[model samples]
Target: MELTDLAPLARSSIGFDRLLKLLEGSRLPEPADDYPPYNIEKTGQDAYRITLAVAGFGPDDLDIILQPNLLAVSGKKADSEARGKGFLYQGMIQRPFRRVFHLADYVQVRGAELKDGMLVIDLAREIPDAMKPRRIEIAGGQARPAQIDTGHGG
Candidate 1:
């Protein structure tokens, strides 16, 4: 099913303005370039992993940066290294690429590693204690009895 607009739904929901805004913003046109395919998987309840197929790129050629709720992954081969590569049948993609990801609140990048021509980036959602759901103790209607001093005079 295709989602056209969420304005009506946003009007009915409470405290979901940001979520609807994100959904609406995602409907915008995406980049035409599909270089360096990637996958995002949920490893755990709050853990996630993003793996990119960077066959022709290495650790030095790739850069991952995180700012606020944005994540950018870019790769570019060195000028000297890119030169002297004369290929008759060029099938592998070696061009520079930049991919940006919109992260949710409290989502942080834990680490990244490159192995077997794939770049893996680890992420986790760390909700603060104050933001987590907590149980509130309900007090009963019964009141405690007051203690009277029946001391020395009595």
Candidate 2:
């Protein structure tokens, strides 16, 4: 319903500003449109898939963009004289639409495909080598005693 107040967290935290901003942005209500419905699914441990029902759209009519932290998908029918022709009862919607997806860190677009009136976008989270968890070998021996040498001649 409402965004939680994060001003107190902002004061104590250093790099959580982005999270706070995301939460604030989500609080704003957006117009609900069921047109061009979509589904997000998890295919693998670190892989995801987004499928959109694009009945009349072709590959050329769609555009997919990858921003720093967002994935945007848009569709626009190409201009043509035939499209202007009058139709008795047009039920299918060919209007342009844009959809955005917020991505977490390290998430990247793998590929996309259009099949049987459905557009599928694949994503995978590939963590960098430096950031992945690694095992550290701990020392496995007892501490050695310090050697002492007495002064030679008094």
- State which candidate has the highest lDDT: 1
Candidates in order have lDDT scores of 0.91, 0.90
Candidate 1 C-alpha error for residue 53, in Å = 0.5
Instruction: Compose the digit string of candidate 2's lDDT tens values, residues 67-144.
Output: 977999999887683368688887888888999999988999999999999999999999999999999999888888
**How well does candidate 1 score on lDDT at residue 33?**
85
Checking candidate 1 for backbone clashes, the offending pairs are: none
Task: Give model 2's TM-score versus the native structure.
Answer: 0.83
- lDDT per residue for candidate 1 within 5-124, as digits (tens), equals 676897789998778878887888888888889999999999999999999798899999999888999999997886678778878888999999899999999999999999999999
Model 2 poorest ten-residue lDDT run: 78-87
Question: Candidate 2: lDDT of 50?
Answer: 97
Residue 105: error of model 2 in Å?
A: 0.7
TM-score of candidate 1 against the unseen true structure: 0.78
